[model samples]
Target: MTVMAKPRPTGQPGYSETLPRAAESAAVARRLVRTALAAWGLEDQIDDAVVVITELVSNAVDHGRLTSIRVVVSRPTEDWVRLAVVDRSMAVPLMRTDTNDDRIRGRGLLLVDRLTERWGTDRYRWGKQVWADLRCESAR
Candidate 1:
């Protein structure tokens, strides 16, 4: 992905960081999310946002093509913070309904579903971005 020296405006505060598509990159992604939320005064959403971003980054590292992925955090509204992972993959993340305790995988998106107000994928010419919106109750 091309790096932007300055972030484009989205009518609210936003930030993005490009990182290697590796497991360790999740830590950096978490810090990016936490920092953005803290700057926006949305600290209450930090824990859930971190979890959501970690899952998204994990999926990207496991399934996405290419060597790097981008993590984006944006406050589109006072009450909502958007966390997104962009990778060079067209694969849409499906939340498996057949997961059992015996199953070792396939429950990450389920956890994301439970924690976020809404989430989905945005496909672009180069790849896809999976994003989740966390609602801040205190912002209301």
Candidate 2:
């Protein structure tokens, strides 16, 4: 389920929704990203943003060890939109280069790395937030 909450009061274009930590959450995350980018006039970013969010959400759902996760979409600047998945795990994500054609897993982060301007994790007392930034080419 997608929660319709107001943007935070920080004067930034941001939207967040809490979702159950399951594989299906990725679909909800994608929709949230599409809506946010379209509203911000960054429709060009929807495709990549969807992939990034799906990987982030999948990682969280599979490895976060929590009951629920939060998806955050924010326009940090006119030329950049940030997508993040917050979960109750402090384990940092590692990119693996050992996956061969036989392996169907472990390539998610690689896709994220190639598609985003930058991506990283922010550790908090309660959990961690993995985020990726997509540059709004049309804004430049």
- In model 2, what are the clashing residue pairs, if there are any? none
Which portions of model 1 show Cα errors greater than 4 Å?
Answer: 1-12
Index of the highest-lDDT prediction = 1
Model 1: residue 111 alpha-carbon error in angstroms: 0.6
Name the regions of candidate 2 deviating beyond 4 angstroms.
Answer: 1-11
Error of 1 at 61 (Å): 0.3
Per-model lDDT: 0.89, 0.89
Count steric clashes of candidate 2: 0
Which window of 10 residues has the lowest lDDT sum in candidate 1? 4-13
Q: How do the residues 1-140 of candidate 2 rate in per-residue lDDT, one tens digit apiece?
A: 99898765431658899999999999999999998887777787889999999999999998887799999999877678889999999899998888667888878999999999899999999889999988888755
